[model samples]
Target: VGCFHQPSIVLADTDTLQSLPKREWNEGFAEIIKHAGIRDAAMFEEIEEVAQGVGDLPALIQRNVAIKARVVEADETETLGIRALLNFGHTLGHAIEAAAGYGGMLHGEAISLGLRAATWLSLQKSGLAAADGARLLRCLAAFELPLKLPADFDSNALLDIAAKDKKFEQGAIRFVLLRALGDAFVSCDITAEDMRAAILHLHEPV
Candidate 1:
């Protein structure tokens, strides 16, 4: 199906989610967290409040759907910058997954690490406050998500892989960085050195 053919129906079955193992459930939360991080500070707080449990899966899923639906409705074809905000952690996330040979880490796990790296970058160049990044990290920690690069992870290799991300254009890669929780914007002026420093920062002990 082409971009014009939107899905006829979308469904969220909480019962199915309720049956997943804890690890799998947390994996799904990574995307949910990403959505909240980029679009709604209040939503992020709600998620953080329930970080240890999925007793409200139905409501949580609904909220996640609503956030994404709003973005999609506004930019169905991704021509508008609004839609690209959905890729908040995916550029670095995808590169990490590729460098890990795809199965070394779960997609969400890689993304969780990507989120931290992105936040660090945001603090440096996007005016994201240190306190905001700390708050986000605490939320991620509550879910036991990864916050650092894997052992023996190669920063140079990851950078090489990131350069191949689909978001790259005109010899620069576009990144979604948060100026504050729930406030994200795309910037293509990030230097390669800054990106490398962000990756390295993730490897440092918190």
Candidate 2:
């Protein structure tokens, strides 16, 4: 059923989000941020302007759902690789979750840190402008998301977990990297060394 079953209906209710704990609400925002960064520049700008306020929950949910719906419509089975672009911050994000024993950090918190690392890698490897990277960092910071690893975090363990990510294929890990604020692509060229550098950046003081 996981492979072939598709939902016949879906709902996006702003009221539901209002009931979530602050951390979980912020967790959902991480995915919203990722969606904008990977595919929708206009949405990214809107999110930057709005930050995480109580003024427009409906608009925020609509924007987020639209971006995801576009991707899913294009790659319902992930056969053409477009849907995988949704994993923009998940590679390192998942590693952070595992390293924390899955309870130390909320998924979005870890992904927020992963977004920083991925953006750094994008700057280094994908022609992402330094100014653009800084702008994204600032946007994330405005959400009060975690942007740095814990001082005592273990980079080596994170790497090991990242290596086991489900996206690994043919002996290489595939990473979704940004070329611009709203453009991203997956590449199998990311090396262990590249990952180490990004993870090290996480250890830096925010």
Candidate 3:
């Protein structure tokens, strides 16, 4: 499986979103926020504006697809770490999802918590301004996604799941941290304690 394949021409029909449950419909916005946070800061204003009500679905879908398309185009097989940037929130998010036993939590909800943790880590490790990080979280909140970790969350269990994740390579954790809004980079310096701190930080009142 050395080759990579993607549709030469892809189509997005925003009208189909009408069929999703209200909760299901909102799940995708977390990804849109992820795209804005990592690759297109300019989209934040539009996101905040549009999320309040469906301001423009087609444009938004196209933008999210375009961001992902560019990332894949740069590293079709993830041979380089550029594709890792797309996992900015996934590292921790997936752990929560797996710990919750998959159907236990909505994928978007778990990811919302992970994005919050990643943003907080960005503030601590990457010199991302507190305001900028808050803004990113605000975008997630705009979609009514869950920011706080579930009260019953098992950190050790989550960490164990994280340890087995594909994101971990060798002995280092290639966590994606943002130097600034729209500027995300993978870091190998994150320790288990730092991850614990972020998980605990989510329990604080926001």
Candidate 4:
């Protein structure tokens, strides 16, 4: 149930919902791996197996829940942490969503691409290692997520939209970039050079 003024979740045709799995879940994994990372090779292997549909999702979720319970019990703080994760790939993804006129691409599609851009920038500017970045790219590719921005997209327009991102603080746009797998940081000091490079990388294939 939602808040008093909140609307109910919309139920779509089963076939339509099944067909749009990429749109629904790509953004989720984009956020999940941002915080979880491929730090443990075993975990990445599990993810790969799951991607191949040879692994069990319920078992994996149960395992993750057990792991999270150690760090945080059921509480508001835990809820906040979950929301924070939801925002992992949203920084740049929101800009792409706006620039593309909101519905041109799937929500997960935009976030998946945004995750790639942010991860690449993090490797250079935020100390996310190259190998870790490469691992993330591999996973995104495996999921069929777009790793680059469309050639016709204008970087300047994206930046302009980025400036309006709700995560901005005191007029400076803030970004969440991984410093390494399983660790991420928010920074407002990202440079114009990095921004330009990220957009260009998005336009060009890696």
Clashing pairs in 4: 149-202
Query: Which regions of candidate 4 are displaced past 4 Å?
Result: 1-28, 38-42, 61-85
Local accuracy of candidate 4 as per-residue lDDT tens digits, 80-121: 443344355777887788789856987767887788888878
What would the TM-score be for candidate 4 when compared with the true structure? Answer: 0.73
Cand. 2 TM to true fold: 0.91
lDDT per residue as tens, model 1, 133-186: 898888777888888886699999998888777777766678999999999999
TM-score of each: 0.92, 0.91, 0.94, 0.73
Using TM-score as the measure, the top candidate is 3
Residue-pair clashes per prediction, in order, are: 0, 0, 0, 1
What's the TM for model 1? 0.92
Q: What is the lDDT of residue 73 in candidate 4?
A: 38
Would you list the rank order by TM-score, best first? Answer: 3, 1, 2, 4
Q: What value of lDDT does candidate 2 attain over all alpha carbons?
A: 0.84
- C-alpha lDDT of residue 48 in model 3: 83
lDDT of candidate 4 at residue 95, scale 0 to 100: 78
Q: What are the clashing pairs of model 1?
A: none
